[model samples]
Every structure is written in C-alpha cells, then in structure tokens.
Target: MSTVFDIEQKQDSAERLLAVADKEPRYILFADEFNKVARKTVESAIHNIELDFSWSKFKNQKQYNVNGIKQVHLLRMQMKESWILDAADEVWLLIDRYKPKRTIGTSGKLKSSGFKHAIYPDPDNPKRPSEILITGKDMILDFGQAFYFKYFSDDAHTAIGYGNKNLYQNRSWVYLRFRLKVRKGDKTYYSNSKGVIEMLVKNDYPIGKTLDYKLV
Candidate 1:
C-alpha cells in the first residue's frame, strides 16, 4: 500500500489537492498542510477508500486559504476508476500534443576572467586547458495566465512562468493559445487556455482533465 506522502510527493499535499480541484467538473477545492506522517495517513486512506477523482501538485501559497480550516474537500468521489484514469490519460495526451516552444533561460557565468584573476594554477600557457574557461547564460520566458474550463472564464487566467530559479523566484510568464476542441453532447464544453498550458508543462496534470495547483 502506498502512503499519502508517496502518492502526494511534496512538503505540503494541500496544494496538490487544490490543483486536483481546478480540473474537476464540480469545481470544489481541497487544501491542507501535511507533514510526512500526516500525508502518508491521508494517502493510505485515499487508496484504501478507493475514492474517485484526479489530483495535482500545488506550487504557490497565495492561492490557498488555509488560515482556520485544516482539511478541504475539492471534488466529490463519484466517478468510476476507469473513468478517472481515462480522463487523466486524456489530459496527459493533450499536453503531449501541444508541447511548448523552448526559449532561452536566464542564468549565466562570465565568459572570460582576466589572467590575473584566473582560478587555475597554470595561467602562463595560452594553449593550456586553464587558458579558457567555459561559461553559460540563461534567459527567462514568461508564460502568463492560463485559464481552465471549469473555473476560469474570459477575464481571469492563472499566471505561470519558467526559468532556472528557486521556489521563491525565477518563473516567467508567457501567452498560450488552445488548439484542441472539447464538446459534450454536441455542445462545446471545454477549451484549453494559457493556464492549462502552464499547468500541463509545470504541474504535470493528466491529459484532457484539469486539477488544482499551488506553489509552495
């Protein structure tokens, strides 16, 4: 039996719970802070109970309101296992279908250091390996605000960014367009947006479905 920590895989599983909610049809949200033991307990409960629904990891704190409440129920466990997994598979598939374009990253090192400041011992030989030092630079690409079918509307969109930075900073924002079509019983029910795009790349949601997301 896999523990909650094993399934959730993060410092706080609460954010993952919310990310799961964002893609769900009911639009409910779940939030909680769990240590390793607590997370394992929840995970065991989820697996043993055999609840139905999808889940995602959360990345930010500003999105969740965890002042007084301890646990949150984001989605009703009603779907069958096959259905849940199928939906997740679809979401993953869609993400694979629309892979984001690679842009330059933003972190770098000095291309050349003066001879007097060289770190290597053999600075006299121009042809020596110490004569030239290899350096690198990175750029930040911002992929701004993504929208989900269940909660996001025309005006509001979830913002996301990518680059080499710590948890607190280094994410850039960019714009994305939806190419796929989602219809329910002859009516167009869902469409991918920028939020979905970022979630797909950053959060690792299943194809064809949405889930709650938070940054920690």
Candidate 2:
C-alpha cells in the first residue's frame, strides 16, 4: 500500500469537489457519507489484514485531526478504488477509460548501483534466467512510490558504452503508458496526488493479467 496520497492525482479532481460545494449543497453530505463509508471499509480491512506494519499503525502518524478522522480516506485511495461521492441530478459518468501503451525500442543502461531498490526480483520466476532491465532514466523514479514492479532481471548490467559487449546491448527497455486523451471540458489533469481521479488496473484485457499486479 502507498504511504502517501498521490498529490498530483488528488489535485486533479479536487477542484470538482470544491467547486460544487456551494451550488450542490447535498454534495457535502455525499462527500461526508463517502468518507464515512471509506473510513469504515478501511478500518475493517486494516483490522482483518495481517501486514508486518498495519495500516492502523499510521493512526498517530501526525495525520488525523482532533476529530480522529483523516482529511481524505487513505485505504480507498491506496486500494485504487473510487466511489461516486456526489452525483448531479442528471448524473452522467464521465468514465475515462485508459489502457497501457506498450512502449519498446527505447533504450538506457541500468544504474551502476541501487538498482536493487527499484528492481524487485520475482521469487516466483526463480528458475528463469535473469535479464538486466535497462529502462529510461526517470522511468523508475516513482517505482517505490506508486507501484512495485516485479523485475525478472538481476544485478548483472551489461557494459554497452564502448569497450565490453553483451547480448543485452541490442535489447531495449519496455514500459507501459496510458495513451493521453483529455476530455472535452477537462481542465484539470488526471493525476493521483492532485486530482479526484481514480487510477485503476485494467482487468478485462484480452491477455491474462499477472497475479503480481494486484495492489493492496
């Protein structure tokens, strides 16, 4: 589970929550109900879950207010789930669907050290030969923050600059992206930290989804 709220993503949808408060007064009730439900869901999930460090451990993390409530529920966001807190009289889902764009042919070398921090060697693929994952420089900047990757690679990086040659010299890095498409009236960008947007995994893909892709 993520320790922090994706400020970028939260900020994107925050304006929506704020702007309609005055006009749609019931929206406040909707938000409060949503928060209450989220808090209960998270509290129950935390109580049942057996993690080394429990989510309840963050109870006193200088976060909750005197009323003993988080400004925004963490568990729902951490679980990548979003509920429609308030719907207009004529509610219409501005459902924005996105899928990963498999990008290949881009190339970069692995970091000399500390790659282990980002590269999570999959224990399930124990017998598979390890490949040094060469990704774009900033591609993994948010590895530990947003999502944990299951790297099938190892610490052995190839020397591709000038002298030594390795079979990986010809290999390129592969990553995924959501093909960008801004809605007609969407002024706020879709991000986790700032927007009130929901980022979720696409489960209905034709190819089988990997088990490791499950989030908390």
Candidate 3:
C-alpha cells in the first residue's frame, strides 16, 4: 500500500495534468476516439433490439405517456406510434442486463424492463417509474443510451430503423452530448469529453505517463 504522502503527491500530479489537458486540442481528439466507441455501443444496443423488433406489436399498444419526469416536457406516444416507447424500453433493458439483483423488500412490486432490471421510483414523478439505479461501467452505457433517446425524440433523423436512408448519417446528435457549450452567464463542461479521455489515455493507452498530451 502507498503512504498518505505518496497518494497526495500522485493526486497533485494528476490535477496538474488535467489542468494542462484542458488547454490542449488533443483532448478533443481523445474525446473523438471515445465518441466513436460510444457510437458503436449505442448502435450495437439498437441493433440487438432491431433483430427481433416487432413493429407490429408496437402498433397495437394504445397511446401512452412515456415521459418519466413531469418537470421535463411531457412526451406521449400517439396511437400506433410505439417507436419511442420501444426505444425507451430497450434502454431500460440494457440497464437491467448489468444491474445487480433487486434490492430486498423491493422485489415483485417494482416494474421491470423485461430484461430483469427493476425500475425504481422517480423522485421527480412519483407516479412514473423513470429512475434507473446504476453504477461503474454501466454508467457509460447509460449515458450513451440516454443521449440517443434524447436526440431521437427531438429529431427523428436519429431514429434507428431500416429504410431510412439518412439513418445515422447525421450523428451530430451523439457528439453533441459530449461537446462543451456555453450560454449567457452559464457554461457546462461535459466530462465524457475531456475527463474520460484523460483517464482512458492514462490507464489504457500504451504511452502511459510518458505520452505527450496535446489537443488538436
């Protein structure tokens, strides 16, 4: 085990490296690599759903309110328009595949994504079970899935389906979630962009600590 002094020194060095990475354009390149992986992950998840997709079954379900949060704008799936609901269910299923068994006292009462991931109550909407509990490696998949859902709802161009010539053509929706953006009196830093890139480079890249950090 390392001593406290050594741990502190390592943390300080990491902080310094992160600070320097913020100014470099190569961070963007790293972010690009991460984004590519994200895209493939999302695509793979979508592909799995499509393999057995039953557009006909979706056509039978009545119109339903799919919105999980009341605070967010309300979204409803109109009659015979189950595409959004299908996609959302797929997201829930992916989360279920990796989450641990249901917590004690919560079994059988909670709704499941059908993949066995128990749905938890949403603090934002008590009546709607939208909150999903996840940790560790699954979080990245969650982000990508959530990103895809958000964009797909906003713009059908991102919809994953056969016969759409423009399918995945405009993938800016995927990249947008990782981009840094600023508004009047407010700025948001997206961690999956630079922060994750730094961590991946440090831990997974062969260059290790000797790698030259720069932004393109």
Candidate 4:
C-alpha cells in the first residue's frame, strides 16, 4: 500500500543505501526497478519496519522471529565446516549422538588426534567426505555428545556429518543445499569460534539480513 510520495519520504529519511545505482530513478521508478539489478537489498529503519512473531508448539519445533521477509529458515543437518567455525563459542561443541564429526580446511592430508582410537583419514582425495575423529563414548565430555575440535593450522576447514545407522553395515551421505545457524537472545549467528552448532534457529540477523545497514 505504498505510494510514490511514501517511497520518496522513506528514501529521504531512513534509506541508507550501500551504493548509488548507475540509474538514479525516482521514487516510483526506483521501486519499479527492483528486478533490474542482479541482486539488490532495500533497507528500512527498524522503527518503520513491521514484523510478526509466532511459532508452532510441537516438541521438535523451536521459536523464532520474522523480519520484513516472510519465509522462515530452520536448522539444517548438512552444513559446511566454515559455518560451524563461525557460530560456535569458546565452550560450545558440535553434538552428534551416534558418531561425532568435525570439519577442517586443509590443502594436504588432514591429521586427527587426542582420542582413544586410531584416526581414520578420508579415502577419496577428490571428493572428501565427512571424516570421523578418534573418539568414543568415553571421550564425551560433561556436555554430552558435543565433540570439541582443535585445528593444527588454519586451512584445515573440511568435514561435517550427521546420521545414525549400523557403523559397518550401510552408510549414506546426503547432499547439503541449505545453511544452518543459531540464535542467542536477539542475535542470530551463522558461525563461531569452537564450531559448536545445534538444531537451533534464528532470524533477520545482519549475517542473514537482506541488506546490511549502518547509521546514517
């Protein structure tokens, strides 16, 4: 229900654009030019933004907030190692009940340590799958199935796994097409220091926001 005049007022007061477009369209013209750019993010002041907060009451479901956008995202099982590294905290750890997994970025062969069993390096060199570290139910800290990982160098960012079946019978690998994250208080985080991630959910965070805004 926004008009040309309303768009002009919004641009004048609250819209802090990241870059000036080549074509400086007018209020209505700019609004109409939404699909012209490859990828564009429009900004609005928080005070001027309207949102509805709600959630389902199922045991498996969690609570989350809705921002200017409509679609809500959930915690995906298959994710990249970089995401865990950025979202985890100092004390947090990635939890996998049956077989714990860790992700590292490495150019050469990756090494594992500090566990009871012998380390199992990946078989396929080209398509490296989720490699399990040498650990057991005994290695499970007070935090339970949350397994903590330490990196040798920095480039060892490769590995992530989640699934519970017969260990030596049949193993399945699923392709990851989504991003998972966490929410603490009013913040939604995509990555962390210790790479600890849970099936938690978050919304409208700067990392997930459409347009990155700043004080004008």
* Cα lDDT listed for each candidate: 0.26, 0.24, 0.25, 0.24
The best-first sequence of candidates by lDDT reads: 1, 3, 2, 4
* Clash tally, candidates in order: 42, 22, 6, 15
Q: Write the per-residue lDDT of candidate 3 for residues 139-205, one digit (tens) a residue.
A: 2211222212222333232312212322343321111111111111121111122111110001112
- By lDDT, who's the top model here? 1
Q: Model 3 clash tally?
A: 6
lDDT of 2: 0.24
Candidate 3: segments with Cα more than 4 A from true spot: 1-58, 64-119, 125-148, 151-167, 170-216
lDDT, model 2, position 159: 20
Instruction: Give Cα distance to truth, residue 135, candidate 1, Å.
Output: 49
Query: For each candidate, what TM-score against the reference?
Result: 0.15, 0.15, 0.17, 0.17
Please give, for residues 87-154, the per-residue lDDT of candidate 2 as tens digits: 11111111122222233346553334211111125464332212222121111111111121222233
Identify the runs in model 4 with alpha carbons over 4 angstroms from their true place. 1-92, 96-140, 145-185, 192-216
* lDDT by residue for model 4 (171-205), tens: 12222111123332343332222222222111233
lDDT of 4: 0.24
